[model samples]
Target: MPINCKKQTLPTIEKEQIDLLARLSNASGVSGDEAEVRKIIREEITPFADSVETDVMGNLIAQKNAKGKCALHVLIAAHMDEVGFMLVDKDSEGIYRFSLIGGIDERSLAGKQVLIGKDHLPGVIGACPVHLSTKEERECILKLESLRIDAGPGCTDLQLGSYAVFATRFQAFGPSLIGKALDNRLGVATLIELLKHCPEHIHLTAAFTVQEEIGARGAAAVAYNHKPDLAFILDSTPAMDQPSYDNAENTQYRTRLGFGPAIYAMDSNTLYDHRMVEFLKTTATENGIPYQIRQPGGGGTDAGAVHLSQDGIPTATISVPGRYAHTAVMIARKSDWENTLRLLTASLDSVSQDIFKNER
Candidate 1:
């Protein structure tokens, strides 16, 4: 049977959208402290959503109801949190010891500029000077114990338990976007665009989740509450597409820049529902949108928790490939971000219960 395609014209990624992405990337929203990011999304989406509410767990769930009866309920989620640090103890007048909030790489911490708390107090991660360290000590990895956040001697407003993040500002290169927290902020911006131009035939539930970098905590609460007929998890996946040290073919490149959106099949926590996977692939193909299959491997997204809710809900994950995730900064291509938006828009426009009728 031939599938009839409406083939709606795709929307272009304009400056306004890029500006939104920049704001989202620049804002500090460490895991469990996503109020800033949540506020931005809420203001942008409130006028478009049929109803909006934040859950007890801090997931911002926005609903856009379909007009007709028997419409399939669809949920699309993008987490709002990023990995960062938490000040645990004060060491001196302006020095503090901090603990990692998520899976941030300790190797990237030395001498990095950081912004602490809501005030954005400037600080630097200080480490032992290389010139003074013994050769044997220099050979070892720098542990968290050896690091201190120095905010300067006059810093009196600093408080323990405050959150801190890299002070990297968003930048637009020739064809790339570089910024902190691009991992999920790219997804956040994508979801915001979808909300503004949602289709009219199906119920749309948009979840801007939190605490995903620590664990998919907010997603779990969202899934249990909404229980949409199906779901799509939007996130940014790490792209190990850099050249191999041996100069050999980089067969293990998880995803490549400019290739297109990466659709997941399997990961550490979830085996994506095949029907949803095929649906996305078919939608992309029919719409002439480019896409790539994310290499099946470890690392999971909110789909890890979403697919396991309430006797199980069918779910799939689509990501924009990014380089250097969970670090101080990340790089992603604008084309890939645009194409990801295109594929999701096309899918939402065409989704139907026929997806579930197909065998699992």
Candidate 2:
């Protein structure tokens, strides 16, 4: 029998894309401590980008030259940091307790694994075993105070000020890609893909922001400095597909996994520019790119800061719909990622005057 091997042409967006995204997502770069993620972005994005620089706040700004040199600037933003905890105190016995750097749903963090410090020490957030807990305890709301990261040999290897971050674990289940830090790492990955394919005529500044989970600090600084005429924020939005007590308006928010990217209209802090929103939708539809309208919105992106900066830039957001956001198991669909790349590339390639003029 002849040994047979088939020649396989990999996908246009190959496993390398997902693998790179996963590596960046898994790397610990909590809010203000983004050196590692920034290094990765600098290395991969610098070659394709025209000019790159770091602002006072450590936000990474990458630019590509465009044919139209009319000083009309377009800025696109995607936050690079994720919600995690900082070391609050360490007990003499080596038990480490921390406070959240951003909004972390305590319920989801009960038994998750985490990383600590520059070396990324492996640790697990401890929880009472089901067998050890009483019926009443099981029904009670879990508190962050009860959580302790098990770093082992607490007195020797662990210190009082060591930070902890969710372990980066990307898993594919059915239609979803579940992992930690997808909230903003997905945005960074989308920007990288955009840079790889961005045409020469699209003159824009891309800012991979920092400290967005705590407050939109990085976005505010970069937007004020650049004063872009138009800005687009790429991010991950919540996927409300699970069964819950609130079902009446819940169906309106069914941004499902694998559906496509989301055209975010409004959130708690920002209302998008109407023309920018319409343009993104129309362009995506005409280009046959998959997309969905985000119904019953609830989260904020860098669009909030970018729209309010300088003389006020017209802004809108496009996000990958994700399940279990702000948790160790945030899940996003590959189709959503692909659609975001398509919509962003199309939007940038054919940016119009009307897109920047819309104030609403």
Candidate 3:
């Protein structure tokens, strides 16, 4: 029986989903240091998976076989790591000098609270006193050169080279969900839901990857190892959906809130598999689920690595629109995430060998 939207009821995300998202948002999974988040994922998914394995690169690979003879092997991925800082040095006064683990706006550095090291010790990025800064300093955006994390006076428990991340906890306000690490944690949460309800036609392989912010390192390895018939890189893409300065027209919003999922035709790293793109759009339209085409240009996701794993695996990215990615906190709509999961689930349920028979 092929999976279709007519007989199947779309899963509604509510408190349980939000609660898992809260746990993921609060966990620390900085690039090259993903232990905390990995632990939580293992606990949540072990029961649902037919087999679970971990690799040297620290990606958690879980498998679920189809109920009958599988027509295709489907690989779905969501990155576990988030952008943060690594302490490079500790000053005599216990101030920590750190380097960013991934792309970040230096402007968000000053006066932000951070949790440093595996112990999750509290710290703050200190700024020069407002009364002391000259006008020239005030006029320009602060750079990484002018920042230091003050763990507090005489605190020496944290070692050099430890990871640091924003101390922001998860919160849901009205129509918006806000938290740190939402960039891919939202993806993480979405993948978890999909795992629980594996479709019957295709054998499902889930990749909970690490080091994505650093360069899609884990994704490349997982794709090579599994080599699915096709792959879907599930992630959170930056919406940048805010209004222009002075309320002027903002034409370049990569995505916008309430637009549902953003399906990638092309991103900086890869041109998505054309047939897969059409399949996703067709499924969404048939189900009356809303979706958007991600503007093609800058930024990328795990698809950058997965699509080129071998001779080449057909890959597409389906992302939830998020605002303020790579910063301390990000916001996204639960409604958008709902449609993302629904649309992807429908497509995967309906997938067949025929989709790949079309042109590249």
Candidate 4:
């Protein structure tokens, strides 16, 4: 049966939200080093939440308790970490050998600018110049061992384990947003906005998780700690919507920009709980919010970890399709982001204990 209820007044994406996204996208919170991003989130959500706590694993959990007794507990998570590099060994005055902190493509590293340490000291991933390389050497793919971070000749401030990220500054390009770390920062911003406008009917637990780029370490810990009735993981999925070399329909394009939120059916990790999936789809349809079923395939989100925690917690993922995720820069449409927020808000507004009554 279709839900018959008053129309939900969805929250609009505003300059404040965009500004917060820019700050999050620009911040360097690679995998295990998410303090800066956590700090920003702590400040933003403090006033709006009923209680806020940072757990042992650096996951920031903020709760908004429902006024009535026995309200459904809903957990929403967005990772606060991004793919980056960590300095390992200093080879020269300003040259350092760094290892990848997450699943960054090695092919994209050479000649890219990076920011190192808490000071964000500028550096570049240096490689042999094309002019200097032999044809045979150029034919082979560049390896991490062959690359070095060139901070500067006089720079000696970098530590052995300092983290670094791409130096891509946030920018609004027409209707799209381009920046580094947009993968999860977009989700982070969305979660913050959701917290601000969270409905009072359910107990909402918003988790800003860390170390997700490496694995779902923070999310696993968060799940065990909070153990909500169900979970929603907000993330950014890759949009392989680019034209193919032969332009033969490009059917494998996982997700696309401007298509609105991509709701997960299945992925590499968890088969999304059918009840949650149906609930989201029904909410989007009834609310007239645009959405796409994310091409079920490789890739996973925080839900991968959350669903397996406790006896079982139903989980589903909703993502904003982005192009070139885990690279120096990624692009996602502003309208898609707005619709994602709308869908999530409407879903939260409509969710109740009855959703669980349906057989999974």
lDDT per residue (tens digit) for residues 226-333 in model 2: 887788898888887776686555575548777788887778778877788899988887777778888745668788888888888888888899988888778788
Using lDDT as the measure, the top candidate is: 1
What TM value does model 2 have? Answer: 0.91
lDDT of each residue in 1-360, candidate 3, tens digit only: 235546258777899999999999999999999999989898999998998888989999999888787568999999999999998977767787889999999998888999988888999998989999899979999888778999988896788889999999999998889999998998998898889888777799999999999899999999999989999999999897788888988889999999999999898899998999999999899888999999887889999999998989999999999999999989999999989988877887788888878667
- Say which prediction, candidate 1 or candidate 2, comes out ahead on lDDT: 1
Residue 261 lDDT, candidate 2, scale 0-100: 84
Each model's backbone clash number: 0, 1, 0, 0
Per residue, candidate 1 scores C-alpha lDDT tens digits across 161-234 of 99999999999899999999999999999999998888888889999999999889999999999989999999
Candidates 1 and 4 compared: the better one by lDDT is 1
Give the alpha-carbon lDDT of every model. 0.93, 0.80, 0.90, 0.91
Question: Which residue runs does candidate 1 get wrong by more than 4 Å?
Answer: 1-8
Q: Where is model 4 poorest over a 10-residue stretch in terms of lDDT?
A: 1-10
In candidate 4, what are the lDDT values of residues 1-360, reduced to their tens digit? Answer: 112333456767788999999999999899889999999999999999999999999999999988789989999999999999999999999999999988988999998999998889999998887899899998898999999999999997788999999999999889999999999999999999989878788899999998888789999999998889999999999999989898789999999888899999999998998888889989899888989999999999998999999998999999999999999989999999999998988888888878889788
Clashes of 1: 0
State which candidate, 2 or 4, has the greater TM-score.
4
Between which residue pairs do clashes occur in model 3? Answer: none
Q: What are the models' TM-scores? A: 0.97, 0.91, 0.97, 0.97
- Candidate 4, residue 329: lDDT: 88
